[model samples]
Structures are given as structure tokens and as C-alpha cells.
Target: MKRIGILSDTHGHWDEKLETFFASCDELWHAGDIGNIQTADTIARFKPLRAVYGNIDDFKVRSAYPKVLQFRCEEVDVLMTHIGGYPNRYEREALALIKAQKPKLFICGHSHILKVIYDKKYELLHINPGAAGRSGFHQVRTAVRLTIDGANMKDMEIYELPRS
Candidate 1:
């Protein structure tokens, strides 16, 4: 089993609370809008980071991370992007990727609205960890933690902090 910490839209801000909250996680996944390279470096220093570049990310971040990330964690196939929509409202590129990749977990960040839902049509879990930075309209910054064991994902948890 691996404990995964997920967040997005940091917009170049890093909080100490985030470090503390994700201390026990085995890996970190960032959906996008990391803002700058330093923010990505900070998270990578903390743990292994799997990430995608967001619209606001600079050339450095985009050079380091892909626009779409697809890989397997344990026995689960996971796909991540920066601007992917959820369920029936998916972005055109994201919808096509989802259909082609058929991942068990689909992760994205952009709307800065926390959402966790099961897309019954695609048989996948969709997670948008919202915005973890202070630069957005989100009143409460959020992150997520979950345990991925074999082919099952469980023990999901959310971390919310007032935008500073």
C-alpha cells in the first residue's frame, strides 16, 4: 500500500502546513499551475513528485513536467493533467485522453474547486484537489490523501486551510 498526497494550483506558494500534512505520504502528485520551478523543487525535495505543467507554469516547469502524465501506481493505472474537467464536462483533450488511456484514477487541477467523484461512465475515480496556494479565488485551500493498495483506493482524506 502506498499513501499518496495530492494537490494542485500552488501558484508558486508553499506552506509549512503542507509539508507537515504530507509528511507520511509515500509520494506527491501535483495536478498543475505550480507557478514556478522553486515550488516544484520544494515538493520534490519533500518526496517523489509526479506532476504536470499548468497554464500559469513557466517554461522551466513545463520543460520539467509533461502536459499529461500516465503511469501505474501499484496495480492501478493513473492519468493526470492540469486542465482536465470532470465527468461529462471534461475538456476535449482530457476526454480523448481518458478514453484512450482508460485510467483507474483521473486527476486534474484548474477550477480550484475541490471535487471527488466516481465517473461511472468511465469507471474511474476523478479527483480535483482544488487550489493549494494563496493566489486564487478559492476561499479555502485544499489537498487530498489516499491509500492505494493493489487495485483498490481507500482511506481518502482531505486537508483544508483558509487562504492566507
Candidate 2:
């Protein structure tokens, strides 16, 4: 089993709380808007990082990460992007990608709102881990952790810190 920690919209900020919350995770997934390459490097040094660049990211960040990432973790097919919408309100590009990839877990971060929803139409779990940086309008910084064992995703937890 691999433990995964997920976050998004860091906007160049990194919190010590994340180190404590994600210490046990085997990997870290950043949805996007990472702000800069320095932050990305820091996170990569902490744990294996899988990331996509968000709209706000600059050339350096975009060069370091893909716009969309699709891969398998254990037995689960996962798709990640920075601007993908949730459920029925998916963005056009994301919707097309979802239909093509048919991932079991679809993750995106752009709205700065935390959401967890199951899309029955596509049979996938969608997660938006909110904004983990101080630059956003979000009142609380949030992240998610879960265990992905084989095809099962369980033991989900949320870590929230009041924005300072």
C-alpha cells in the first residue's frame, strides 16, 4: 500500500504543517498553481512529487511539470490536471480527457474550494484539495491524505490550517 498526500494552489507558499501531516505519505501530488520551481523542488525533496502546472504558474513551473498527468498508481489509473472542474461542471478539456483516459481517480485544483465528489457518469472519484497557499482567498489551507492499496483508496483524511 502506498500512502498519498495531495494538495494544490500553493502559489509559492509552503507550510511546516504539511511536513507533519504528510510525513507518512509515500508520495505527494500537487494539483497545480505551484507558483514557482523553488517550491516544487522543496516538495520533491520531501517526497516523490507528481504534479501538473496550473494557469497561474509561470514558464519555469510549466517547464518543470506537465499540463496534465495520467498514470497508474498500484492498480489504479489516475488522471490529474490543474484546472479540471468537478462532476457535471467539468471544463471542456478536462471532460474530454476524462472520457478518453477513464481514470479511477481524477484530481484537479483551481477553484480554491475543497471538494470530493464521485462522478457516476464517468465512474471516477474527483478531488480538489483546495488552496494550500496564503495567496488565495481561501480562509483555510487544506490538504488530503489517503492510502491507495491495489485498486482501493481508503483511510482518507483532511488536514486544514487556518490561513494566516
Best by lDDT: 1
lDDT of 2 by residue, 71-119 (tens): 9999999999999998989999999999999999999999999999989
Global local distance difference test of model 2: 0.95
Candidate 1 accuracy as lDDT: 0.96
Model 2 deviation from the true structure expressed as Cα RMSD, one decimal place:
0.6
Q: Write the per-residue lDDT of candidate 1 for residues 44-142, one digit (tens) a residue.
A: 998999999999999999999999999999999999999999899999999999999999999999999999999999999999999999997999999
Per-prediction TM-score, please? 0.99, 0.99
Q: Which residue pairs does candidate 2 place in steric collision?
A: none
